[model samples]
Target: MEHRDVGILHPGAMGARVAAQAVTTGAAVWWLPQGRSAASRERARAYGLRSAAGIRELAATCEVVLSVCPPAAALDVAGQVAAAGFRGVYVDANAVSPERMAEITGVFEGGAVTVVDGGITGPPPREPGRTRLYLSGDDTAVARVWALFDGTALTPVALAGPVGRASALKLSFAAYNKISYAVAAHACALADGHGVLDDLLELAQLMLPGTPLAELEHLAAAGPRAWRWGPEMSEIAQACRGVGAPSGFAEAAAATFGRWEAHKDDPAVTGQRLIADLVQGSSSST
Candidate 1:
């Protein structure tokens, strides 16, 4: 299989989206049966991306395979790709530390597979071609991924040296993002506890001197509808665990997402609710 004949391996919604985006670059897309998520599977179906019976089929079929599964499942998928003898690139875009990536690479180092480390920053592209994706791997073919993204709307950059640098970048970014979300939610929830969500909003607007309250508000509001975040957040938690960071913080974030899942039908998924629920932990969230 040639690079142009590369196939994409996506196991979840992000993979589906990335696979969908891959079409613009003219790569073949392949995946396991779409999961239970209607919104995600629908997107893949709409794009006419091909579906395989299992991981074995995708590995045997795609030359260059990109996987965006959660960190917990990332290594497992890599092992599967190795078992299926996937030649060419096997990029793991999971939210994991560089150390973990190295371990994952060891599983297939002897095979024909070239492991590419990928890290995705920011949200999925709402409009076509605006997503930022990064790839890092051996000196060879890293540029292939960069060029693939360059050909599309995504701004793909290839980082040189070491297989894990890209994944390290992802973990560092996730740490900051998780912290920001946790802090922002906690602060606003404190305000709400004292009957000051609005007052905090006003004071924040005035005090911060052009803060990102509006954008942050959008993220907070989308919390309830963000069911897909659960698997991703679980990966974030595992990354934190790998590095000895306190898992309590990510545990809070997970609970926040859980509340959103529980009350997706309710329109009142506000900042206070997220903060209070996350602060209270997942079990007592009801």
Candidate 2:
């Protein structure tokens, strides 16, 4: 694959890693820092991404632009890129429902842009073989996007479907993976409320063994990231409802994650403290 110029819109944690991986493919990765926070600027500098004058310039120059932002901001980013006269392939890798994904595609309609639906599963691609970027849309466009990841730490998997199919797959997978974390946190909270936390942990160790115990650690680690997961859980709920599936659990998971808002980005928060807060209905106090 020939080297291509790629633009990464708003390089947050995952986006910064993606930009770095794109750099390994010999692509000149550009990021616009006009309105970004200081931390975002620092991240872009650390990742060695080239600075673009603005979104319009980034969109005008890059062969492909990747939007790896929060689901709520995905449409806005796509609209801005489209308005900037971007004619290249636009890849949206946000954790949104299929409905929202289609809406994003619609935003680029009538523009010279070709939309590629992408869903990223797994953490940042700091290590090879740990992350997969699932792509769907026009076959040729998907192939073009896939080629950009060649020889990079991120693995690209092409899916046989139209736009929104990739987002569906992503939300379906996240529905279970993230909801389980909420379930574990809720279970521990309930047990703690009943003064049976130790008993429940013992029972889980004897019955389910390693995984259940590990979830406790996962719950603790998720505290700082819960703000993001809350929106994702809500997106899962929307995806479920779109298909006439029961969305109660996902809605509850959203609420469960919302409880951790106070601890969002706080490194000092612990699993025990989160559980206790849940049981006491005092998560906001944190």
Candidate 3:
């Protein structure tokens, strides 16, 4: 299949790798360097992505543009694309509530652009079997997006529904996947309070054999990304409430993740530090 030109909205950690996969497929992946940090420019360069002069150029040039930034900026990114007269397929692959996803779709209503709903599960595609990208929308558009990563490390699955299905699936899965990490972190805190944290984790491994809870390192690593996950947990809560499901756990998980937001991208965040932040309801780093 002939690959089309693709534009990645922002080349952060996940977006850069995703763009690299598109590049590997012989597609020209573009990113706008204006207003991006030095790290983003370096990542884009490392991934072999072509640089667009600006958002307007990116919007007008690429046949497809994928938005992989923070959930809070999804709408704004869509608005910018819409305002810039982008008439191609726009894939929103951010972690967001279905309602928010619909809002993003609505941004392109009556426009020439085709909005595709996408939800990326798992981490950045460093290797096979670690990440999956869920897409739902017009079958042809989904197929087009699917083909972009068909042979890459990131697996793309087309859902059998409308625009919101992919986002709903993403938030639903994340509600459990991420909140469980928060729960385990708290468990670590509780156990440590009584001087039995290691023993508790030992037992936790038996109960959650294949899960991240089975290892303290996994839970510790979760803390540094709390800045990203906190908003996602809130989005999960909003998603649950939209579907008439209980949202208390998701809401609490959001708050729990907030306590560790100060540790965003900090490599030094440890299991004990996460517990301390939770126990104090704030990060000591603050």
Candidate 4:
């Protein structure tokens, strides 16, 4: 279970940071370059990650593989690793529901790979105490994975349960955190459409003096990332129903996020522009 070489599948923003942290810990980090973008290649280079020709090479070479892709790709990534005959530790650190986590776990069933569920809370860790990676699985495997992250910016905490627990915790946390942002954006959009946005802002400031209008920033930031969040919201809705809770809010949040598909990742879009566009879209749709 001692992994000296770690492979990070598809080093996006969060994956790159995780690789950088592993590099700082002197672990040889590897990434697959096949089908990856130039931006991803540059990121791997900047993080000092070694490249493998493909998934098979990566799975064969590394002792541990960190699957940090989007939630939708989690199962496929696991399948790739499993098919590569990877017999080492596999960590899935995506934002997915417990049910999806269980499904991903099932992918590695009958394989030598030990599946560890990971839920990363907070943003990419740039400093100590900024984020935590919650791991749940077999005791020995979880400990091994936790040791890999020891002393890194991304603090790893071993959860006292099986694989799905970590993902359940992650989905539960994100359900509220992200859905609240969607609600705030929709509220602002409604206010803007009704010509009471300024009035609402003033009222909020007067009623809640210490709170800043972060919803505006959230909406602007969400424009590019809404595509991802839409699925995440749906997963959250599933998580809600799995726990016997009402899922109407999360379903609505998913629909609201879906409306932002047109502006997905548009750097030119501003918060005001996002709000106006969302309001206009709502108006036109009706």
The candidate that achieves the highest TM-score relative to the unseen native structure: 3
Order the numbered candidates by lDDT, best leading.
3, 2, 4, 1
* Model 3 Cα lDDT, one tens digit per residue, 17-136: 998988888899999899888989899888899989988898888999999998888899999999999998999999999899889999999998888999999989988888999999
Per-residue CA lDDT of model 2 for 80-190, tens digit only, reads 998898989999999999999889999987878899999999998988898989999999999998988876789999999899999999898988888877788888888
RMSD of 4: 2.8
Q: Candidate 4 lDDT (Cα, whole model)?
A: 0.83
Clashes of each: 0, 0, 0, 1
Q: Write the per-residue lDDT of candidate 4 for residues 25-66, one digit (tens) a residue.
A: 778999988888898999999989998888888888888899
Scanning candidate 3 in windows of ten residues, the lowest lDDT window is 208-217
For model 1, what is the error of residue 253's alpha carbon versus the real structure, in angstroms, after optimal superposition? Answer: 4.8
lDDT of each: 0.67, 0.86, 0.89, 0.83
TM-scores for the candidates: 0.80, 0.94, 0.95, 0.92
Residue by residue across 206-272, what tens digits does model 1's lDDT show?
Answer: 7764333423454465465445455556666776787788777666666556655665535556555
lDDT, candidate 3, at 8: 95
TM-score for candidate 4? 0.92
Clashing pairs in 1: none
Judge candidate 4 at residue 115 and give its lDDT: 91
Candidate 3, TM-score vs. the true structure? 0.95
Tell me which of candidates 1 and 3 scores higher on TM-score.
3
Q: How many backbone clashes does candidate 4 have?
A: 1
